[model samples]
Target: MHEARSASVPVETRAADYLQAASMTAPLLGSGSQETPAVNTYNSACGELTVLLRSSEGGRLWNHPVTLTGNNSTYHLRLEPASHAVWTPNYFTSFELEQQIKEKLIRKENIHKGVGGALVGVRKVNPPEKFAPPRGITAAVTATLDFHGKDATLALRRPAKQPTATVEGKTRPLAANFSAPMSYYQPPGNLMFVGLLGGFNATKYPAPTGLYFMQPYDPDRIPLVFVHGLFSTPFTWVQTINGLQADPEIRKHYQFWIFAYPTGNPILYSALRLREELAKADQLYPNHKPYIVVGHSMGGMLTN
Candidate 1:
């Protein structure tokens, strides 16, 4: 509420619109919040959510890429069904890390990239009036596979700007996850252990000493860099990042990034590293929006 009234937040309007559209669209999709539970599976049968996720270390979401997810989608259809994904949040220290390595360790995909999910509708193609529905695969089919990934992201951000989909001859708001990539991003680690590890041995579990994006780097949205304190790693801010992004206002306008450095290093050296990284980013993304750097504890000194 406070942000909506504040003019300084550049994304207030778009964020407000997304929230409004979501409220109106959720009930229609039959995937309402905990408070407004789905009436029954029958209602949700009209639509089903397929989360598209990238493979984690030593694991893959599937054996191979299947139809309806990647480049195979057809845009001419208007209602393109897309795949959905999730990155489960895992910030708490995994006690196992301390046992095997006997050292606080940060284990992540290391490489952050890949597709999100999609919400598609599946309904009976043949009318129910047909008392004698045909067996086999003739009774029901995938009614529509609307939008997915980035395509869905833009539509929900500014609902009015894009064309609405017609489902069952009725216009409907394109269903999508308001917060992509971030909402599903789950980085597994013990923050305290990893932080101390980095602070103790710069080389063993060193953090990338540059601007690392939590999501795809959006040129339009301003960059918000989070720096962790002494004996801390970017994992320290995972929950904080998740919470901030839950709000449409912040998610729409500001892309989150992190400045990770081995806390064991001298503060002056780390600050210089940050300055150099910012300069490089500016060069790469010319005419980009101003940046907002946030620091905690020792991180505060680096920002200053």
Candidate 2:
């Protein structure tokens, strides 16, 4: 006998306290059916709280293809954006620094155009790897004006926690896909070569440049900057960051940053440039918390 292949998504099993949409009243398929459980949408406190994600150029994403990934849970994912991750300085554009190092900046995300697409999450059960549920309605709405405020719209652009919505007063854990925003800034495969080339050709690739941010800046959280050694980029810190971020205390109190420099360059020049970048960042974003710099290899000398 062949082992049955399971493709069940982990959904809330508790009593359904929330009102279900009339359309959802249709009887669920029988146990042996091949169909997957459909995405459940219920009435929210806002009557119908919905997520409306779109491209910056005003294109529709409803019909676009998506993939699924996660362990013990199903996450709907779209890899097109991730595959096209950038390596340029302005992976985003326009911060106050261009106009004046003197300008007081609240946060850089306010100046960012946004990274990529959203991660769709499934509750735990099936592997987060390639778990796609099928059959859903699609429609588009045109409005005279958007109802979301500046903060809401801005938050939507930033990489966020599991994509979730509160229905009534209860918070439900929906299926969640991963958020890999840093990958959007610089593709890992190219970092090593870039760091190496930058050392030899100072003109082609400069050292100790653009302060890369992984998230929106907050005055409440202290900044923790990571400096990588020769022939390396912040990509080296991935596992370390993954572990640290797993800690709630670290996540609450610290914001991560990276300083990229040409490793092959003279130590002093690289150090000088690091200092200049830090000073400029301080002038623009004067936070109450002291800066925390961590360095590895040659990056250690400069951090000091």
Candidate 3:
């Protein structure tokens, strides 16, 4: 007889109440008055009320605890000051909290493997935690990937993108996939190479293999491989590759290489083919250090 798989798994749930959208009018408080509080939105399942604050100039101010009064369809809020108030309009029901969590998990998973992809089913689950203010409001986010059916945890930290060079000294904005190559050569040891590999069909017009090199000063170490996500090409890593190349600390450790492929293909098929290509490359340069594969988005999913 075939065994049946267990149906229920515990999921860790975390709640965050943020000011989704709000507008500031003449700040006036009180009931039965023409003035009303600014409205924000949130995601909640149990009909819980969470307070959110907004600044008149713009942006969020603070989040507080409040009770959600009224029926499930429409929520009514009362502020302590009762004067000019900040309210969340139909807050709890309008957001896709679960989907957001799933996307976050998928992004986190890709970071470790140096790839990115979509999140699938949950193998295991845990209880959610209440929202806490993060350290840097404008800082880049760090993602944590906890895979189900496995005891592995992957933490991915991606730096935010800064402005890039303009075209012909003009202020023309550069595309995310601009090409920037930096390479180096090491003497006696294994050669460490790094850079961005252009995707197969990137430009509307035919483009050559775009390889952006980031080699160590010594040049004799095995290079690390960086794989990009779906619909993304080697150009996506231009900023990251450039930063790593410029960092003296990173330069001393290893070389870098970017792998670009046609994102239109199936992820597994691409990965399998990539594995074979890597094998062939390894044969050509036996002394080169083994590659450390990194993929993003769909590429991340493929790595697994």
lDDT, candidates in the order shown: 0.42, 0.38, 0.29
As for TM-score, the candidate ahead, 2 or 3, is 2
RMSD (Å) of each candidate, 1 decimal: 18.5, 16.8, 22.3
Where does candidate 3 stray beyond 4 Å?
1-219
lDDT of 3 by residue, 1-304 (tens): 0010111311111111111111011011112112123210111111111111121112122223222211111122222221111112221111111223322101122121111111111111123111101110011111112222212122211212222112112321111111111211111121111111123333331222222223211135446677777556554554565555454345435666655566655667677766765665566556776667777787677667
Off by over 4 Å in 2: 1-53, 56-165, 174-179, 186-190, 206-208
TM-score of 2: 0.50
Q: For model 1, what is the error of residue 53's alpha carbon versus the real structure, in angstroms, after optimal superposition?
A: 13
- TM-score of every model versus the real structure: 0.50, 0.50, 0.32
**Model 1 TM-score relative to the real fold:** 0.50
| lDDT (tens digit, per residue) of candidate 1 on 14-123 | 23322233323433443221222222221122222111111122213222332222222211112232322211111110101101121122222111111111221111
List the candidate numbers ranked by lDDT, top first: 1, 2, 3
Better of 1 and 3 by lDDT: 1
- Largest lDDT belongs to which candidate? 1
lDDT tens string, model 2, 1-304?
0011111321111101111221232122122112233222221100111122222223232224322122322223221221111111112221111112221211121111111112221111234111111111101110010111111111111122222222122333222112233222334346557767766675556333645655545576788888888777656765566556555467557777777767777889888988887887787676647889999999999978
